[model samples]
Target: MAPSPVRPRGRGGYWLFLIPGFVLFTVVIVVPFVMNVATSFTRWSGVGTPTWIGFGNYTKLFEDERFWTSFEHNAALIVAMAVVPTVIGLVLSAALFDYIGKKFGPRTASALRAAYYLPQVLPVAVAGVVWNWMLHPSYGAVNAIFGTKVNWLGDPGLALATVMAIMVWFQLGYPVVIFMAGLQRADPALHEAAEIDGASWWRRFWHITIPQIRPEIFVVLLTCTIAALKVFGPIFVLTRGGPGNATMVPSYFSYLNFFEKANVGYGSAIATVLALIIVVVTFLFLRVQERDS
Candidate 1:
């Protein structure tokens, strides 16, 4: 009898296909994360040898008032980023799809969606810079429009809230587009049935529209919360965390330590803390999704 052909020993071609992506992931994510975790427990200036200092960095974080200050700012921004946008987007999208589709036309609704999504298309840095100038105390359009000299980015009390407003402007478009897309996939027949049963617009929205778009709501909330947690570009350009650090956020704080202060260990620790917080938040969001599902 002829000897049986030797079988291949491994998934050679399949492993080859995975090599590039696996290498990329190891280099981009795993290595850096391992480095960050290691550095967080040591003292380093990004140039010299790192000295292991145990939980020194963790202790320092709590004692450092700036860390808490930045965290508070981040917390407030969550409301601005997630809550306001989700509510307003729902209302705006409903108005366009439900009311406008009845009276005007679908094309008009489409045009308005594009218009609302315009702010999100601009680069964050560009939008921040433009708003920085627009909120200038002297020659800014805001002062011009209101016929008053208001230092929007200067006062400690107003600086953070003003930045929140700009954030709202930047974030508004995302949810509107997402909600509108969700609305498109909803059954129009359900709305007609509800209408025939004499459901008012408010009742229908609460019962019908919301239930159908629960997944979109979670998407919007989770993404916006993450964005708020990592907010830096707008703060960097607009406020520079000014007005006595009123607008400082965790990401910018990490940046300040890593670059300006040259405290690599501290910066890494702060970043690791942020990563943990994000992980927890995502876990909670996923749990919520599971329970609801």
Candidate 2:
């Protein structure tokens, strides 16, 4: 008689379950990405047959001063969003974790976490419109607080800064929640040991807290960098990349090419470049984190 055949289970079943998800992901993500790259090498006006243009679109990017400016603005946004908010969020998260999570117990901590996440639950379009009114200069809450009538969105000098400020306000909450989760997973015995040793608050944070949450730091940095790189809604709503293109970024520039200017090829080229930059930055960050770890 033939030996009984072995049946697949556990890992085999998991792999089988993942097939549908993998197929859907490839269809939605990989196909579009390849199509975008193909579009980048062709001169296409959405409705017409695409003509091969070699590197013309890419060469044109180097000569376009507005494109460079937009790229520079995006770099600035990446730095601000990655560094500034991480610092602020880390400090606030540490404080909340200490005060609410540790001292006041789980119930209060859950309530506080819910409050911080409220802004993230709101739609970006609504947030953009609300921020536009809040920073409207003459009639805005910001000006009213400072008691000075200054053009926030209308002035070229202030437009970029206003957009940055709005981004910081909205983006901070999600990171705070991330940090809190990291804090919850940290070993409590480490804190107890530090307390017994009479370590100062700063000493404890620098030595114990940060090293334990290194994974979270990497996550927050990468997420914030990607989000900032593609910022558009607030710029569109508040300034329309305006007051003479002072508030423009790569995402808005690409949108203009595709929608307003009707140059699909140029837009795809910009998008491809943006995608390359994101991939490179994320790769570098992961390598650095691995080295440090």
Q: Best candidate per TM-score, number? A: 1
| Model 2 residue 148 distance off true place after TM-score fit, in angstroms | 1.9
The window of 10 residues in a row where model 1 has the poorest summed lDDT is: 5-14
Best by lDDT: 1
Whole-model Cα lDDT of every candidate shown, in order: 0.94, 0.85
Q: 141-254 in candidate 2: lDDT tens per residue?
A: 878998989898889998888777777777778878898899989998998898899998788888888888889989999988988888887777778889898988989899
RMSD of 2: 3.7
The C-alpha RMSD of each candidate to the native structure, in angstroms, is 3.9, 3.7
Q: What TM-score against the true fold does each predicted structure earn?
A: 0.94, 0.86
How displaced is residue 207 in candidate 1, in Å?
0.8
Candidate 1 residue-wise lDDT, 128-216, digit = tens: 99998899999999999999899999999999999999889889999999998999999999999999999999999999998999999
